[model samples]
Target: MSGLPERIERGFAAARQIADAVLLEGYVLYPYRASAAKNRLRWQFGVLVPPEYTAQGGEHSHQRTECLMEARDGDRLAVELRFLRVQRRTVEQATAAGFESVERLELADRDLVEWDEGVEERIELLVPVEELAGEGVQRPFRLPGVGETGLVHERDAVVGRVIRRREQVDGLLWLRAEELPGPYRAQRLTVEVENSSAWRPSRHATRDQALPRSLVSAHLLLGLEHGRFLSVTDPPEWARPAVERCRNERTWPVLAGPEGERGVVLSSPIILEDHPRIAPESLGTLYDATEIDEILALRTAALTEEEKREARGTDDRAGAVIDLAESMPPEVLDRLHGAIRGLREATGSTALGRPEQPWWDPGDDPGVDPERDRVLVDGHQVGAGSRVLLRPGRRRTDAQDLFLDGRTGIVEAVLHDLDGSVHLAVTVEDDPGADLWRAQGRFRYFQPDEVTPLDGTAPVEGTAALDGAAPVEGP
Candidate 1:
């Protein structure tokens, strides 16, 4: 941001916040230790493998993101490329002669294990909108190679040493723009990122060997000083055709910042909706494993002291997670459990016979208790105590409904959707999961047209042997 134009850096505070999360999506996984098997496999997304090695067949050597924009004269486009560069950390123990590279160097305080660490890197360039209009711009860039060594000491003697090595990763960026025929002056912007690194590997080299030359978790953030970018995922009706014509390869572009703000675009490998925001309830990133912060924090807290110590030594980010988990207060951990993003005027029974109500908001829908609500189905009154024979035939029904076609279930509730259709939630009598689903306030929803009214709420005695077939369909 230091070199970027002031306006380009203005509203990007929120955009960068989200992009940073994307960069660390898979940096590390559970049990965050160098020895952890899953930790060996990192950088799961947006990996542009070296071209020569990619010819052997694996992830592609490039990614392309195309989006639509509305810009005027004098508008400048700011492009910021961010990615993780793999830094190989090797531990070496001090020998009588000199230092020797060892898999692990054990110290009194902690263990130092050889691991691949991700170092954040960014490239910023501001190009005028005019430059990207006609033939556009194409340029080649390189992430300069680096190698460094740090001495490890204890008391007076230097017991061991650590080596960090990184190979150069070369890449190319191509930006092209075309004026589209539309109601307004619109342009299609295409950005292509390719990994053209010349590093070649030996026969049958593992992916780990290729990391030093590869682009890990690559993504781009585009800012418009005066113009606005359209939402690629949810374009307006007039711009749908143009948005569809844009071909995005491997990566997608989404509107960034608050909802409806189109000044910025976050092109990433992960699929997300427009205006994607990190939940305020989230304490911090857990590196995209399950994304259940509570569960990950709990598991992190449960790690043995020895394991925790190794995790802390694996990487700075891992150490931060370890410290966060250990120091998180109980109330803060509870905040991670649940959150209500927002609420609206909710209605009753998302699917009853009358005007449908929202099932999510509990207290809004008055006089519509599932236990007391009754609806007429096939000229028969059916409520929470009524029984029915399922005959599911809806075109959108799940395949499992075929098994429930003839099964008998007791109606648990009568629900209604916004449409004029009615749905009866029922629990199958013989289902092993019936109790579990019922306790969770879930039931199999059957429309009035999908079920036949059956007599009595109690299970027919001595007739459980009829299998799922309706037993003596009584009036």
Candidate 2:
């Protein structure tokens, strides 16, 4: 609601200059943290240059450029060219600025300590964008919903808030917005169409009305006070007329539905909002309540004994060990087995068995389905598969290494990644080479024509039942 600040304008100017020369380049200016005091304030910055900047015959050859600016109280302005590390202040000078605590210089794990331990501390900086970019920067840093010029627009249309974002079970992102407040909520609704495969939110609105690119305007919608609205709300002052016009005329194309089978039909007159130039980080916090609530609901659900064991990354049960043994390499398997043995020894258990199973019970089938790679133990489906792997030891580059393996089955699941991939319980027949099937995360992206849908192919009944009171089995 407030106007853009002068500092932001200046920052944008500096950012533009840096981006001009190093298009697609990235830079960071971190502030220094105080060592001894909880509320210590220090100024320090770290510059990051992309590898492209140092490629042969590249424009810039510097590596990890750092600058220390003078802590001028009244006039806060600084700029530097490509080559130099702008020296803001020395250790002695920093002391004069009230940095006297020697313990402040202490680091956590001193593995790779670098220079400037005296004044070097990682801090978040609020610097001018242009200064952050260095001089002559042109390209904009595209983050989250920001655009090429750090401005957000839809179909060249500008509205107020993001009212609704419908992320379908099939990986589709649909957004609906009403114009800024003016009229009743019902009359203000306008749809904004964005095709995932075709459109990027960063595309700028052009003057050329005939171009298909221009068809995707940056329409605006007003966010309610709490930030989220599933249906619709009144338009803000700037959007009253536009929202009314859109509603009455049924202008924008929204709600993409099936046309026949291959193509999709979208209702027209997509509504949108331009991102504010300068706003508080919490301005749009209310809009994410729905997503946050959904997440909480998922977290609150109870896990079965097997589910809890797998969740804890433990191999106390035969089912879980089976899952691990099927997926892990020999060395990793040995390490895991040793860990389990150590745990059993420490707990005074003679054998490694299901954590929840009785000491005399080893035949307790946890209901692990190795053929389908789904583990239903103790009446609950233990785990499922995911698209992107985010395990602690399994980074993206680790490929399919991010999997929940058990004697009965192995399910690939995501730990932290946010790709369109899902966590599903899939069945594999005798053919381990058969196309991997996933079922759990609502999406069913079957490999093209690999398996036809049949009545029995749906998830087996009782798949959702809680796993409870099953006899534990030993590994």
Candidate 3:
């Protein structure tokens, strides 16, 4: 992939991160029981509810996500949607004999065994696409399946059925918008994929026990022939309300948006990449070959040993992933390191090849010591009174009005949260002159990673007094 442009490569990497986030969003470890506390938060991202939600007395907030794109007249866009499905197994356990029949008395609790039942009937949906005009006139088209498993069949312009197999529980749907038909201009086009399915409630279950009808881990890969890729992290004006509404409800929304528009603009974790479609010259053993292996290693490391066994038993793919992680020889590690070195040399960023290790508490008293713990601002240590620039990106929360990217601010204080996360309180450098003591609200709290220290401003040894006023109680 060195043949690809650097911007395209960055976009691809960002997209991959987003996709990985989506894949593991609601993924619970093996022994996937409904009663598990960790499993309660399933289907949080890209949830498309079926029409049956109306009958079930629940509102379907959204059924599809739309992205605005600019394409040249002759460009073809490729869309890919990948997601996993829930599979269940039922096993019978012998009931303990207390005062039951004499024949039942012979069997003890240790004698009981559980056997794997055949797979359950997989749910099907129709993932149809529509190209909307400027006036919102939708021209529906069936998104046909590309592969040989025959999972998707286009019946008409309005419907495309997705038939997933029991063995192949997950799905990957591919659709391409070929050459535009009949005087259709490609500039400022609207593309929407509907996860159309009817909700089917579980038999012999109460209303409260019903699960979400539709769930999809969708990542749109838009390949433009002649046009440049803009952004997957920004949402259109029309979709902002929906995004905000979902955020207010404390749920992860699909809209990625306008960062400075009132509160923090949240983006969808959905991954997207736009790349040239031409086949690359084959390098016998490129770094890209080990991408999946690396991902598997990371995922396997996250699981406990018991969970690993359960994963191996239920999922062949998971088993294979674990095996790959285990079977990697020292030579492979050396090659991977060499690949990283090459990448760093090409990119001119020393940060590219650094290995990221998970944060662990080595001993007791892991809490942050406000005086001793120095805040890292874009890899450099900075303290109170230090001038810094806000890093560009959407923040989880925009409490202190640090929404503007590359905005400069002056550090007022370093505060530590109850959870041991350190935050820097900064007052915007351009803010209207106000009494620092009285206008503490103007000072925003930001994580150290969100800002970069500016030069010539040495870190102050002690916290600066707000305009020589008395110290405030909290951030």
Top candidate when judged by lDDT against the true structure: 1
Q: Give Cα distance to truth, residue 457, candidate 3, Å.
A: 31
Of the two candidates 1 and 3, the one with more favorable TM-score, higher being better, is 1
Compared with the true structure, all predictions reach lDDT values of 0.82, 0.24, 0.39
Please write out the lDDT profile of model 1 over residues 1-475, one tens digit for every residue: 6766666686587788889888999788888987888877778889999988886647788999999999878898888889999999899999999988887777765678888888898877788888886778888898788999999888888999889999998998888888898568999999999999988777787788888888888999999898899998888889999998999998989999887788899999988788899888888878855478999999999999898778777877888898899999999999998998788744544344465744456456674566676665544556777778888886744898788778899988777655646678899989899889999998888876677779744334454333322212212
* Candidate 2 Cα outliers beyond 4 Å, as residue runs: 1-85, 92-276, 281-426, 430-444, 449-475
Clashing pairs in 3: 235-256, 256-267
TM-score of 3: 0.38
In model 3, the worst 10-residue window by lDDT is 103-112
Model 3 lDDT tens row, 99-139: 21111111211111121211212122222223323344332
Residue lDDT tens for model 2, 1-475 = 1233354333334333222212111111001111213212211111222222223212221111111111212322222111111111111112335333221122121111111111111111123322222232222211122111111123563211111111111001122222234333322222222212222222343212111111111111112111122211233454444533443221222211111110111121223122112121111111111122222222222334433333222111222323332344445423322222233343353355634435443235343332233233334333333121112232334334334222122334212113422233334334354353433332221211112212223333664343321211221
**Which regions of candidate 1 deviate over 4 angstroms?**
348-475
Q: What is the lDDT of residue 154 in candidate 1?
A: 88
Best by TM-score: 1
Cα lDDT of candidate 1 equals: 0.82
After TM-score superposition, the amount by which residue 452's alpha carbon in candidate 1 deviates from its true location, in angstroms, is 16
